[model samples]
Target: MPYVFVGSVIVGPLLGEDAVFGSLTAQLAAFAVGLPLAAITALFPLTRPMSVAAVRALCDVPGESLADGPARSRTARGRTVTWFTLHLGFGGIISGMSLALPPFAGVLIALPFAAALRGSRVGMPEVFGEGWLLALSPVIGFASLVALAGCAAGAGTLLARWAPELLGPTPADRLAAAEQRAADLAVRNRLARELHDSVGHALSAVTLQASAARRVLDKDPEFVREALTAIEETTRRTVGELDAVLGVLREGDQTAPTAPAPTLAADLDGLLKRTRAGGLRVRSAVELGPQGPDALPPMVSREAYRIVQESLSNALRHAGPDATAALRIALDGTDLEILAQNPLPATGAASRRGGGHGLRGITDRARLLGGTAEAGPVDGTWRLRVRLPLKGPHDHDHDPKKPQKPQKPQKPKESA
Candidate 1:
């Protein structure tokens, strides 16, 4: 609507006498050329930033686009067409009336005054003898134009105020934005969990080893040397894990190493050895059925290793100096069971029921792999047990050519 008014105002002066006194064909031709341009101006989709600037320029108010994308629905397109048509029609009417009426009224008064000067028409001399009214015609026309300009400005302001609501993001765009936010949040949460499990375990081990080394510095030289070596090894491994986690967030780093992660099934013995080196007595038994450790998927192996690592760190942190930990890994059919148990301190059942982030991490890791984990005091011993399902829902079709082998369950053999 405002566009129509502004266009008519600018084009009115250019039309001159033809706007008011031209033939019907001339008026039709003028309108035919102007209307389409008005429609294009109103219906065109501007970029969001440009639209904001235009709205502020037109109505002196801030504006936002209704749709983020260039695509618009049929209903929205229909509404825009209707608005532009009404705006152009109404503005043309107002502008034409203002321009035509003032001049027509001026001529009506001026004609009598002109006739009075010539002393030719009836009653002309009685109304105006001097031509003073003729001089005021130009002033009246100017005032009428000023009044039309003011009206158009007010209407444009109102239109700008309503623009943002009509123009802002559609429902689909909003949904896509929300989904993107959720995905980003999930990534950040997974990174936080990984960092907490990896770095926390390493720090706990280092603290225990360093404290033990310091205590035995004067009493046992050999044990002190072993503790220092374990501390150094733990620090180096922690640094590597930290690099792996951080590399995931780096962008455009083509030189970074792409190495496979170490798994619990393959590195179980090394982990147990490290725990023993930290002055804890650990007895471990690993028994893989017919499929062996290779049967376990990479993701499952990595998570399993983290659970065991955190559990061992917890045992070292909470259990007494004489605590002897037992670890059992057994694969029976399509399930892998990991059980770690340590003798609780003499401080009753309360000491056995220790709670911390390590326990929560173990539970989360197992649950994520479609497995179950239980941790608490079981018959005077602190125990952490996790059972994971090896066969996924689509595992049967994963390698259809491989023939199945009948297997028998074997008891896990204990070793010191």
Candidate 2:
């Protein structure tokens, strides 16, 4: 406020007629006034955050208004102009006028003293016998000063509240910001799903293979060698997939290497082999009757591979040591059906301890490809079934003799 008063004092005299003589001088004076005002007007928007910091420091209050200072919209530039005009133009004028009030009161209080000093030379009669008016001058001046302070505080508080409403972002800007945040959240969720599928499957495979190798290290050296080989291959593949996913997150580096997408027809056999080597008895069959990998889109193929991989990993981790897991893939018309079933163990604690992300990841992948998935225990066997549309919307009749579709394969739903 004092700074504002000082600016008022500095600017008030420059606007007087005596400061300018000719038209040239008048223009120069106008420029002098405009230059500082223009600078303040242009810089206030950029300096709003700094101003917030200053206000916080002065008020000793960590207000919510300060936190929202940085979110001003592109459309609030006009508000900055209005704020500058009010703060500097009217604000300075008001300060100058208020500052004049106290001095005017003092001048009024000094009038009787001047009159008495003059009356002493002319021998004029004393209007007040006890000189009460002279004594009241100090009291009046103190009252004026107190009023000034009260008004200053009130005005400052009002301006503080009013500035943010005008200078901050509009409702549209806030809506845009919310939508941007939602988009960012969706991307992060997709990345998390990818990481969970790829890394989780690899880790599950490593655990199973390591345990099998340790158990058969002396009795079956050949089996142990195969287990070690499987472990190495899984780790390397996981690292490559991790690098590919992380590469997408790198900023300003378009040349980063990315792993190519894996196809269901090519990668499914390798996935089954790894699971078999991990120690569970596995039987797999693929009947791509009409549509092959070329017929399916790349996205669908990759998601299908992940779904099978996750399903196999879950079976290896959950199904008992002697349990036989069966996997079947068949294309019926324009729909691809995938099913995996294994005998449920008497003790279900092992599956619960594995964190239960495999089925959820599979559901997310299938849903992303516009498909359906269902997984649960049915007739004493844990079953996972998914039916994805290869072409657009089309009905494909499933022959129960081939493999009973598990519970009609409900549409994929997001997990909480």
Candidate 3:
């Protein structure tokens, strides 16, 4: 292989000088031709050692043949040491041969074996007599070097001539790698969105309920009890949800059964009732907005409830215990308007700057319903205003009776 590789290098320069390909092109030309030739021969795979010892033996053939082969009866560790010694003697001979001939030839023989055995132990067998090996090993090692050089040179030449294309990176491998990266990025994005929605809602609820419970402790024990209950329930629910989410990542529980998801239907009414109980003086004026024929959509109700719930919760937390929280909902043309507000406290925490997921989540929910939400401090009070399009959960068209008239009806023509 070494001779063949050197021969190609020399031949390339000569061919270029002959003007087969101009002088400037020869640099690229050598690699282009050598690559295809290397592929066709499949020379490297066949000649390479399966283990460190095999590589060393091939490189230092003469030394390996003369040295004592490892006793097949030896223990694995003993045999490994014996094998290593044989290779070291082989490598030394190859290195010496390089000084006698061209340095590249020695490199072509010894370097591959060294790299293959990089992590392996390189020691001689202590059990064997050293004098016996030391004497004949050098002579055998020199002969092995010459044989390996001759073989490497022939194989490398044949590969370079016939299968150069196989030597380079393939298009298929690159495509597979790119596809894996894309899939990883997609999974990360989904996890981020789920965490944002779950943790944001739970934390906001916990904070609001805790603050309210503290204020009502002395004045209204019953109300305080209710708020405390809400806190416990919310905490327990959050933990269960988190466990289920994390369970998917655990290897030990590969077959672990997931806890059933909590249903909103059973808890929503209790959720709403408790907030009103928590010193908010909440007034519920919610009425189902008109739907074309279909019933109210589950998402619409869920989002609407969240919007009102979060706003009132914030009102209780920041607007003071004595503050009056009012919630109103009514239909305005094709939209449902939800407005929640509380009086500014005489001395209390400043208005919360943004709607918690109660606000943001509601807004995102509204957007999903083709609606919108606005929340901010308004005229000595905090206001949450939302406009939800009045399309029932299943309705995709307007009600037939409620014809959309562009102009008022003209006077009847019966008299004419």
Best by lDDT: 1
Q: Number of clashes in model 3? A: 21
RMSD (CA, angstroms), candidate 3? 18.2
lDDT of candidate 1 over 1-416, digit per residue (tens):
34443544555566663352344544544565567766566556643334445555665553335444432565455445544554556567676767666665555445544544435443233444446755665565566667776777766765665555544555755777689889788677667767877788778778888888898899999989889889888888778888777765653487877434557757767777777777678888778765656657667777778877877877777677867888888875577798989887787543535467677777777777788888888888888889987766425434667665655565655677
What is the model-wide C-alpha lDDT for candidate 1? 0.67
* Clashing residue pairs found in predicted model 2: none
Error at 25, model 3, angstroms: 22
RMSD of each: 7.7, 9.4, 18.2
- lDDT tens digits by residue: candidate 3, 1-416: 33234435766766755642344355345434544453333223321223334433343333222212222322322333333333333333344445444533343344334544222243333422244543444454566667668755654444333221221213443445568788776455434433444454566667777777786689989877877887787677667766655553543566777654332333445555555544456665644323311233444554555555556656756777556777776556667688878877766345667645455566666776788888877898878889988675425433556654342323321100
Best by TM-score: 2
lDDT of 2 at 39: 40
TM-score of 1: 0.66
Off by over 4 Å in 3: 1-266, 289-294, 329-336, 347-358, 390-416
Q: What shift in Å separates residue 35 of candidate 2 from its native position after superposition?
A: 13
Clashes of each: 6, 0, 21
Return the TM-score for candidate 3, rounded to 2 decimals: 0.42
Instruction: Kindly report which residue stretches of model 2 are placed more than 4 angstroms away from their true locations once superposed.
Output: 1-16, 20-134, 167-169, 251-253, 261-266, 289-291, 348-355, 391-416
Q: Order the candidates by TM-score, highest first.
A: 2, 1, 3
